[model samples]
Every structure is written in structure tokens, then in C-alpha cells.
Target: MAACGLDFGTSNTTLGRWQDGAPRLLRLEGGHVTIPSAIFFAPGREAVIGRAAMSAYVEGVPGRLMRSLKSVLGSSLLEETTPVGRERVRFRDVIGRYLAGVKARAEAEAGKSFDTVVHGRPVHFIDDDPEGDRKAEDALRGIAESIGFRHVSFQYEPIAAALDYEQGIAREELALIADIGGGTSDFSIVRLSPERHSRADRAGDILANDGVRIGGTDFDRMLSLGTVMPLLGLGSPMRRGDLAVPNAYFHDLATWSSINRLYNSKTLREIEETRRDASRPELLGRLHAVVEGERGHSLAMEVEGAKIATSERGGARLDLGWIEGGLAAEIDRDGLVRHTGDLARRIAERIGRCLGQAGVGADAIDALFLTGGSTGLPHVRAALTTCLPQARVAEGDTFGSVGTGLTLEAARRAA
Candidate 1:
């Protein structure tokens, strides 16, 4: 029996364990330490998770593909059910099934079962709602216990990243840890030192923790609305008086967690009704094709890919030929900034709140530590760095730092 650390991120997951005097991320999928947070249920077969889940859906396998399962916590949707083959599965159960699979993989790789664990959680699961935040953590703890972990504890995600960063530092410093993932952006200001790494309690060192629900998914949604939704009649006029196509359908389509809600018959009927009155029936026809074909997830995936491409290469072309012949959109770095700039501002503002909570000036910070997949976005990085011009920037494993730090926590607790 061993204690493991789990990072159930919105975009990806990783499990780590303390070994050989350090925290080591265990391989979860065929030598890959990190796996996409995805699951697919193909008719009568068992659910497949991680990369295989994404691959199965992309390859056109007949199934329900669920991504961003972590986003359901603390929401009414968690108790709601979605059709999974011949069964209606609650979102909570879906999350449990996914975590169970992840646990099984980690155990198999480590050749041992884990009955105790440390889980990483965002600073605020639902920003500004204390009850919702508490509910989310309780729900996650319940899920972890239900999955056979007899003892489970949680660490704030950005704080966990700070712990990992502390392991390599030689001196004490006031550091701001930024963990921007698929579903949320979390920040923490802490006094970290190699000397403090082995301390059993770190309450005094942690100054402030703050976060927002905005993250990579929000960026994807904004980018989609800016670049792709127009072709689907997002802002086009309708035949009716003074009406444009309602933005609700386009928004749901652009959001990863809400995409599936647009795939049912009721939504289809709504699209049809709207299409009948749309001035540009051709655009509505494209929307109809997307809904009727249940291609919302596919479209979101394309948008996400393009966002990544734009971040890395400064631009990317979105091919929507599958939705309609010759349908495509071009998005460049400038356009991405134009659409997602507000989100970046909100994130930066949250950092200011964090600084205030810590009672420290920006220049007083010695270092800025960044982890999480979304931190790779150029504009997002610039926003954080710009806020602290004098602080030196430090980077952690974008997808694994939190889990690795959780492993260290687990080891400490076990000891």
C-alpha cells in the first residue's frame, strides 16, 4: 500500500509518488506521465479514458466523449445525467469512473495499491462563492473516498506548485505562484525556502491564495466566438423584426462543458425554429449541421487546437470544411489578443487582489513561479510578468508540478 498524489486537472491529469528521495510522476498511459482529461464510452464496451478516449472520438467511434469532467464540481450539473450508450450516467458517476481508471493505471504502473492520497484543488472552485467552493471540495473528497482511498487530503493547486518550486531553490524568497489550467486560474503568494520544504506545517509561510474561474477554456470559447461562430450565424440578422441569431447556442457550442447540452432533440428543434427565421439561412444551415450531427465537441477541439497553434506560431487556420464546403476561419496572434484580452485583464486583476491579500507590494516579490498548461499562452504570460516587472520568472512542469508537489505532501503526511 502506498500514498499517491493526484492532479485531476480540467485539461489533463497526473499521478505522482515519493520515491528515491524525491517525488516522481508515475506513468499513466503507455509511458506518458500526463494524460488528457477525457473519457469515451463506446456503446456496450467499457469506458476508455485519457488519450485513448480522445483518439476514439476523433477516429469517429460511436460513443459519448466527455472532457472537462472536473468542471462539473459544485454545480447542479454534477447530479444531472447524460446518455451513455444504453444507460443514463450521472456526471458524478462519470467523474468517479474516470478517476477510478486513472487510479487503476497508476497502481498498475507502480505495482501497488494506493489507499491514501493527496489531491490538488484550485484556490476557488467557484470564484466568490464560499459555499460553492466548500461544496466542490467536499464533493471531490467524497469522490476520492468512494474510489477506495481511505485517507485523502487536498492542497491548493498553486500552493502545490510553490512546494515543487521550493524543492530546487537554495534561499528563502517571497514568490507568487500562478497556476492557470483548463478551467481556472489560481495564484498564491508564499515565503518559500529550501529550509521550509521539510516543515510539517506551512501555514505561516502561505500569505494569500486567490483564483478565478477563467482559464484556457474561456480563451478557447472567446476565440471561437471571435473567429468561428460568425460563420454559424452568431451575430447575423434574422428575418424577424430587429433580431439577430441568439448567442446562446453559439456560446454553448464554444464552451467545452456545455457542448453536449446542445446535442439533444430539444436543442435541435430550437435551432430549426431559429433557422426558419434567420436572414442568412445558409449560416443557420451550418449551425443545423453542427447540432444535428453532434459535432459540437469536434468544433471545440478544432478551436482549442487553433488557440494552441496561435500561441505557439502566432497564427493558425481553422478548417471547418467538414461543417460546410469551403468553410474556414483564419485566426492570428493579434486576433487572439483582441478576443481574449479582457480575460487576461481579469486574471491580472486577480493577481492584484492576491498581492493586496498578502499585504505586499509587487516589487517586494522575489520570484514569480508559473505552472499549468495555460501559462504557455504568450499574452497570459505577459500579463503576469508585466504585473511584477522586478520579480524574476521561474517555471515549473506545466502539467505535473502540482501532482509532484502533492506527492511531497503525501510523503510528509505518511512520515
Candidate 2:
């Protein structure tokens, strides 16, 4: 039986295998190694995953589109069910189905069944909630078991990236691995050397691990609240004259994992009632149109696009013609800095905690290994580098490093 490595991320998923002593990530969808962690349950058609799912949703398909499935793991919503077409599906089953899709694809590509697999997960599924964290991993483990994997194991996403980075090093070095994914930002301090690459026992190599439950989706939420939510009456005054339009609806709309909740009849009715009491009825009218059209995810994608664009340019403009005619908003880099400053600081603080836990100084680190898609953002990269100014920054395959590294681990464990 062949064993493969799976990096099941919040935003994307990748599977890799060891081929002739080299780790190679399998192309899961149309020559792309990384598949968007998205699913669409069409009303009268088969469910779609990855790029096709995103495309189908954007093309106005009638269905429930779900992204950021991993974010629900440690939350109360994990135990709840939501309407996904004609049926109500448990959040756990939704995740299991997604993982099952990944497993089936890998088997088809490899032309063999995989009984043993290694999966990568964040260091902390839920910060400061030990029971929630344990339950989250247990939930994932159960999902893997149900998906036909007889033997399953787990690896920290950041450590997996570190192992992949370590394979190319010429000499021993103390490296900091910063992995900022869609749902979490994790850090690991490890001692790596080419000489140690062949060793099966790497427990001594890893010094410390630290993480916070914040990542790209959180950034998207902040950006949405700061820029897009206002246009939807998020801060508009109600007829009560003293109270503002309820923020919960806008918050749910901005959150990837909770956006689907806004589609229910109760939420829509509440929005309508709020609109009647809203001082700015026109803005709430636009909000009603969005909720009625089930376009929360579309709005979120627009904000995410703006966030990505700001990384390269000074600013980006969002076209919201779906909500209102000729409506646009400009999001600047400085605004991103202001909206995400607290998150960046929290990430930096986690790095400090990792260094302290490892009993290492910032100057003692030889290199900083950056991986995960979220690290591509300028603000995220700056946050970690600013804390460890002495270490040379090295970026691995931003999206594929963890999957490749997990492939190495799977090969070792199988041997």
C-alpha cells in the first residue's frame, strides 16, 4: 500500500508523494498542485470542489458554496448543521466529504490505494482552549478514518515546512519556520542540518512551537469590516436614534465560515426589519439585495482580492456593482496596515513567545523560513521579519512546502 502526505489547509489542499527519493506534489486539479479549499453543492448537480467550485459559485450557480471549512473545526458550529441544497448537512460531514474528495483524487492519480497517510495541521486549532483544540484534532482524525485511511498520522504544518527547508541546507543552522495559512499562523524553532536529514527520529531537532488562531481569513474579515461593511449599513444609525444598525449581520456576512448563515430566512427577515428601522434605508436596501441574492461569499472574494492586490501595489479598488450600481471602494495599503495592525502584532508576539520557549535569542537564529500562502502578504512577512532582524529570510514554495515536507515524513513513517 502506498502512503502519501496531505496538507489539508483552510484555504487550499495539496497531496504529495515520494517519487524516486524526491518529494513531488501531485497535480490535483488541472495541472495545479494547490486546490482551493472550496466546495459547491449545486441544487440538481454533483458537488464540485476546488477551482471548479469557486468558478461555479462565481458564475451564479444555484447552490451552497462553502470555503474556510477548517475554521469551523474548533468552533461551536462544528456540531451544528446547515442547509446545503435540499438537505441539511452537518459541518463535520461537510469537512469529511471534502477530505474524502482529496483522498479519492490522490488514489486516482497514484493508480493505487493509500492505506497510510500523514496529514498536516496547525499547532493550535483553538488558542487557549485545550479541550476545543483536542476535540478539533479528534474530529479531523475521525474524518480521516471514515475516509478509508486505515492508518493515519498528523504533523504540525510549520514543522513540515521546516523539514522541507532543512533538506536543502548545507550546514547546521537554527531556523525559525513561520507558517501563516488561511486559518492559523504557526511558528516553529528547529535545528536543521543536511546530516540529520536521513534520521528517522527528529524529535530532538524541533525546539518549540507556538501559534495563534489568526490568518488570511481573519485579515479578510478585518478588511471587509473596515471597507465593505460600512456600505451595507454596518455603522448606520437606526430609527431608535441612539443605536447603530446591528453589527452581527455584517460580521457574519464578512466571515467566511459564517457567511452561509446569512442565507437563512430568519436572518433575512431580521435584515428586513433592521432596514425598516434604519436611518439609511437605501444602504440597508443594498444589503437586502446581497443577502437575498446569496452573494455574501462573492463580496468576501472582492475584499480578499483587494487585500491581495495591496501586497504589490499601494492600493486597490473594489467594484461592488452586485450590491449597488456604480458602487466602488478604494482600499489603500495604509488602511490595510491600520485594519490588520493588531493581528500583525499578535503574530509578532507569538514569534517572541516561540523564541522564549526555545531558549534562543533573536540573534542566534540563522535563518527564517517562510511558507504558507498567507505569508505572501507584505504585512504578514514584515511582522515576523521585524522581530528577527538578525536572521536571513528564506522563502520556500509558499503553497507546496508543507505538502512536500509531509511527503518526506510519510515515506519515513511508512519505512
Look at candidate 1 and give me any clashing residue pairs: none
> Which regions of candidate 2 fall more than 4 Å away from where they truly are?
none
TM-score of 1: 0.99
lDDT of each: 0.92, 0.91
Task: List, residue by residue over 1-415, the lDDT tens digit for candidate 1.
Answer: 5899899999999999988999999999998999889999998899999999999888999888899999998789998999887779899999999999999999998889999999999998997899999999999999999999999999999988998999899999999999999999999999999888889999999999999999899999999999999999999999979988899999989988888888788988988888898899889999999888878889999999999999999999988999987889999999999999999989988889999999999999999999988888999999999999999999998898999988988898888
- Model 2, global lDDT: 0.91
What does candidate 2's lDDT look like per residue over 267-368, in tens digits?
889889989989999999988999999999999999999999987787999999767789998999999999988898898899889999999899999999
lDDT of 2 at 31: 87
Model 2 earns a TM-score of 0.99
Model 2, residue pairs in steric clash: none
lDDT of 1 at 277: 88
